[model samples]
Target: MIRIRLGARGLGGVRFAVSPVGAAKDLLRLVGFSPGTLTPQWRTRATDALSRHRLGLLAVVGGGGPLGYAPDFIRPEPPAFLTDINTGLHQIATTPQERIRYELAGAVNGHAWDPGSGHPPPRQLLRALDRGEDHFAHRLADEMARFWHAALAPSWPVIRARLEADVTARASEIARSGLAEALNRLAPNLEWRDGELLVHMRTDSIHQLTLDADAVILTPSVFVDWALFCAGEPPGAPAPRTPLIVYPAAQADCLPPAQDHPLIGAMRRKLLAELSQPRSTTELAQRLYLSPATASYHLQILHRAGLVTRTRRSRHVLYQRLGGAT
Candidate 1:
């Protein structure tokens, strides 16, 4: 069975009905980081704060192939952040001696592969998923098993399994008690929705919470992309953002003739038209049929061209078509 859990040490709660791939992708979204193969730097960057907060970790695990059950799992409720249960799991699952045992066990079956060990790193695993590349997922699953075996089993499971259980139990009680009362008394701006079970941050505030979940599982680290949404200005307040694409107006004499640059010319026209109406990365990506990264690249080129300027309104950066020469 693909067991998934999302909670910290003392407070356990969030649960979800998702596939392993979905869980992994969701976690990646939360942390504001890209996924693909592995990278040396990724280990340091993703886990640094995890080390500090020692705050605990949440997991979303699932399996459907021969090794997993098919019932599908879902988080009946949202979890409260109290302690670091998942991180505690990592300590046991990723330790040296334990990792060695799991690695060798898998290696004997000719399955010992580490996506993060070689170049390209494992983030590509996710990149491939984004592109709908099937082979990549198969290859990733094969290697992912080995990676998890080495990184999370024997070594990390020892401590993680125990802590996760405790956290999950307490979280359930806290949620049953109606957290809004304590939450409001502590910080008035937060709101908890019955359906989504998410603690909505109405203002610039930080508060601790406890909650419950049905199943609990742990992944290695947090996904880094959620920051773009969670840390931004309050919802409905024009989400601030910088221009993703800039282009010099061909009519302006300063920019080199646009006759030779169709890409630049097209972008210039589009930016000019959109100058009055702001669009988000997602909207722009859909409109242009380009990946967010590709859109960002085009935007960077435009910024360098000086055809557009950026401004910060609250936590968001907005782009404006500037009347200037490149």
Candidate 2:
């Protein structure tokens, strides 16, 4: 029972992000490191890859950290938008030695094993951390980058679509009902009451705290399934500037709405071809000689099919083809 009391700054400061690093980390945990369960295809892919090559440092901290504590330094602070995995890996690679020492300490400690797991904590990289080696951080980042490309990249578009769809829906809810209302309904284990966000913990740990960060990062994960996870600089732990909460993504509902819309018309086909680069509907409309309404209608169909992804840039929402994988 962790009570995250949100002040006006915290409530008004809430933001949502689609984190590739987060999903990738959760996938690693779900498949082999933890009691988590990934969807069949994801489990098979991740498991096969893990069996083939040893991730060394990544496998050490893949579940984030030790004692069910995921370190904050590994994943860069998400900025309410989607970015490629390299952007995040760079952040991890350049993490300061002091920060890494503070955060990674708990992960490498001998007492950090999961309770029911038959195996001990992964501690092969501890000697490097203990020796105050800056290269250890880069090595960790390198392993994560390799693991993500090998195991997660193939299906990232599918996962990205699911994450963005959830964020889009939740953002809409925040717009309509206000952030307070949205928080109350974010997950089964969470509720924003009065000025506090109550997290019903699966563990017996109980505490009262304040949500006193610049922004609350809400990322949705397909691998997390029905679980709601909250992490921050808890109690006396190394302080993280922003608190993070991961909710279950709406995977089942992410795709196929455009199936009913269908990709039949010549207009849609042409519009899809034009979206190879990001373009606002107005730009697309003017280029194609179609009305903005006609352009938007077709673009919406393509977006729902997961073939294109839309992002708000300045005053306009730009759409780009997500790759031909769909």
The most accurate candidate by lDDT is 2
Q: Give per-model TM-scores.
A: 0.25, 0.73
Error in Å for residue 55 of model 2: 0.7
lDDT of 2 by residue, 1-326 (tens): 66666777777777788888877777766554464345455566676666566776666666644445556676677755786788888878877766676665545442245444455555576665665546877887887777787777765775677677778888898889987788767777878887777777665353345544555778787666444444566545544557777777764322222212345367777786787899999999999999999899988887785668899988989999766433
lDDT of each: 0.31, 0.68
Q: Residues 1-326, candidate 1, lDDT per residue (tens digit)?
A: 00111234312332211122322323222233222433333343334433343312121112111221111111111123322334322322333433233322332222212233332222332344354323332333443333333323322222222233333433464567654342222212223344222333222242222333332222212222111111111223232211110111112121112222334667555654565555555456677777877766776665554445556667655655543221
Cα RMSD (angstroms) for every candidate in the order listed:
21.3, 5.8
TM-score of model 1 relative to the true fold? 0.25
lDDT of 1: 0.31
